[model samples]
Target chain A: MIVWTLLEWLAWGASGLILAWMVADALRVSHDYDEDVLLSSREGEMIMDEPHDAA
Target chain B: MAQAQAVTETKAQPIGLLRVLGPGHVWALGVGIVLVGEYMGWNFSVGKGGALGSLIACWVIGLLYTCVAMIDSEVTSTVAAAGGQYAQAKHIIGPLMAFNVGLYLVMAYTMLEAADALIVGDLVVALAAGTGVEGVDPKPFVILAISLLALLNYRGVLMTLSVNFVITAIAFLAIVVFFLSVEPWNPGAVLHHADLLAGLPYGWLGVVAAFQFGIWYYLGIEGTCQAAEEVRSPARSLPYGTMSGIITLLIAASLTWYVAAGLLPWEYLGQAITPLYDAAQASGSTGLQVFLFIGTLFAASASANGCINDAARAWFSMGRDRYMPIWFGAVHPRYRTPFRSILFLIPIAVSFAFTGLLDQVVTFSILSGLLGYTFMPINMHLFRKRWPLGSIERGYVHPFHPLPAIVLLVLCTATFFATYLGYGVQLLAMMSFYIVASLWFAFHRYKYVRRGDQFTMPWPRPRGY
Candidate 1:
């Protein structure tokens, strides 16, 4: 019984941590960058080696 | 616009979806999503059509997906967008078609992700039960699985798919290893083929019915195209990577059928939860059983992982075009991933998982995917009509254009009827859901779609226009 309780709480703790991290990161990125630059990437527009697509 | 332009000119950094992926990741994303079907769900075809009937369904529907791969490879080669078929629809058909198609992609994959997480949770319960720890709830595990995968996808595309590649390969190799262990060359030894082999219990209609489940062998391979925007070279990588995925599925399907059918009686094989694992157990080898168990778990995880990636991309694309809230379209500055879209879909997938209606959700997902395939032909015709061969650059051009379209249509229709035969209520439910969704879209968010700025293809002005 004790083991099962621990397992459930562990699962919950891990999931909550991950979700909170993602939310915090999303908030940070939103504040730091301009929206237009964030959305600038287009479909198959940029090649990896040469980054002229955004320009 | 000026700040954007100034920043772009200075750094020229790629904005949306990091473009570090290659064919290997594309193959991983595509196969990883579909491989779970081979691990489970597919055996249900045997339930419907019998073993021989199931094989016929596999071959016939194999041809159906072949056409799907070809169509997707060709169109995706040119369009090279994140939404896969939805992107193609937007480019060629019109806005409404694109909107519905994108919705289909999001809903199908999101539901599938839910289903896979459910499977993982169940498997975890089973694992615990094996250790005499019974009565474990699968819900928390399911939530844990979804949240962790959402984190992986939220961080970056390359790492998400890279992890998928390793696990998917292990899951696939498990099938190979099991096939060899059975010593299929000497079927008389362990297989008992003579006693196990049974003729089709039903008849031709059973074969037709089996076609409904037949898609399991190769479903979701066309998802390769969803990686187009992220691939280093969409033209070269998209076509070949997708093609490689289909060929690999074909081989895997044949081996899976040959081995499982030989080991388990069709009656048991059809209804078994883990057919391959059950087959391994039947082999009476502890090593093989462990291998297959690991394979099943990894296949489910890999599938959930890929589904998150694809669903988020489709939702992100739709959001990018303002068909839904524009906020979902935002990409993470550091990760270059569709962070918001990924976060948004996690709850939706968890909701579906909690529903615990596994068969219903999977059926709905498969039916949605079938509807998406039916649109491929229409998208193809318009694509070719506007820009005939040689009119513009294409990464890869599929040969014998209209025939594959016609083949895909016929097979899809047969499968739809097959689905109707069993899941009649579910079929209607899916259509009604779509109709209601279409009505909701028309009345509500359709206004958000910018009519003028669409048709952003970089090729020559379409010939007729």
Candidate 2:
């Protein structure tokens, strides 16, 4: 009984720890960087310049 | 103007997601998101038809998915972006199609994630009571599973999927182990295939109806393309990974059917919530039972994890194009994850988990998936019509141009009717929901989109336009 209870609480703690870390990291990144720059990365253009027929 | 654009470009490099994934990660993401179905939910086909009907549905739906793989591999190769089908729709068709497809991907995956977490919670509760530990609350466990997976996704993609790869492989191997343990060749083996066989109770129509549940075997296998932006070589890896994942599923699905059908009666097997575990129980070996229990748990976890990854990517892609809000488009500077979108979706998935309406949640997901497949044929047709071969570069091109597209169209229509047979009300409700969502997008969301930014792939201005 004690073991299962302990396990349940540990699971809750672990969930909280991981979530807190992610939230903190997200905040730190936002604080350090500008939103315009962060949103400007639209990739895939110029990926393949030549249309070589793979026939 | 050029100077301003240059400044943004240079600064954007630091916030860009890393291209660190390979074919293995692609295979893991695709398969991990789907392996749970093999453990449960698929046997419902037997309830609709019979053992033989379910098997036929498996092969026929297998053909449908093969078409899906071919068409997806070709289109996804050219449109290498995070949103998978959503990205392809935007480039090939238009914004309305893109918005619909993005919603389909997000809803399908998020709901599936919820269902997976629900199964995990239910399984934990059931197992605990079986061992004399009653009064366990499943709510906290569901939240814990979703939270931990959301954290993994927020931290990094590579680490998240690498863990998915390991757990998914173990879950897959569990099926293989069951098959080998059965010893199909030995005449005296436990399998009562001869007696358990029930020739199609509902006849051919039953077989047709069973098609809906047959999808459980290979659903979400095309989700590999959701990680296109993070792949090292989108062309080679996406096709290879997706094809390999489907083949693995084909083998696993067959083995699962053979083992479970051989052990249990069709009537009970069809309704059994955990068919594989039930089969293990019938075998009377605690070892196999324990192994299957763990496999079910891991499969659900891996699935939930992959769902978080795919749903966030789809939502993030839409936001980046201003289909939703530009605020959701921002990437984390340190982790390079779509932090805002990931966080935004956590509450939505959690709310879905809290609902605990397993059947409704799963039905909604299946209908959404069918809707997404419905768009693939049109997307493929337009892609080829507008940009014929060699007009623009393609990483991979599906051979027999219109054949796959035509076949996919026919199969998708059939599945819709099949779904209608059992879930008619749900199917109509789902369509109405999308219709309402489409109206909102057309009226409100369409104006926010930056039309100039739609053409992200390096290809010619499509031949017609």
Quick one: best lDDT, which candidate? 1
User: Can you write out model 2's per-residue Cα lDDT over B1-465, one digit (the tens) per residue?
Assistant: 765555455454545566778899999999999999999989999999899999998888888888888889889988889899999999899999999999999999999999999999999888778979988778778989999899889878889999999999999999999888888887448898999998999999999999999999888987988989888898999999998998998898899999999999999998999999999999888999999999999999999999999999999999889998988888765456788889889889888988999878988998999899989999889989999998877778888879988887898898899999999999999999999999999999898887997778878877777
Per-residue CA lDDT of candidate 1, range B260-315, in tens?
Answer: 99889999998898899889989999999999999999999999999999999999
Worst 10 residues of 1 chain B by lDDT: B6-15
DockQ, in order, for the candidates? 0.42, 0.23
- For residue B269, model 1's alpha carbon misses the true position, in angstroms, by 1.1
Q: Where does the lowest 10-residue lDDT sum fall in candidate 1 chain A? A: A46-55
Clashing residue pairs in candidate 1 are none
TM-score of each candidate's B chain against the true B chain: 0.96, 0.96
Badly placed stretches (over 4 Å) of model 2 are A45-55, B1-14
The docking category that best describes candidate 2 is incorrect
lDDT of 2: 0.87
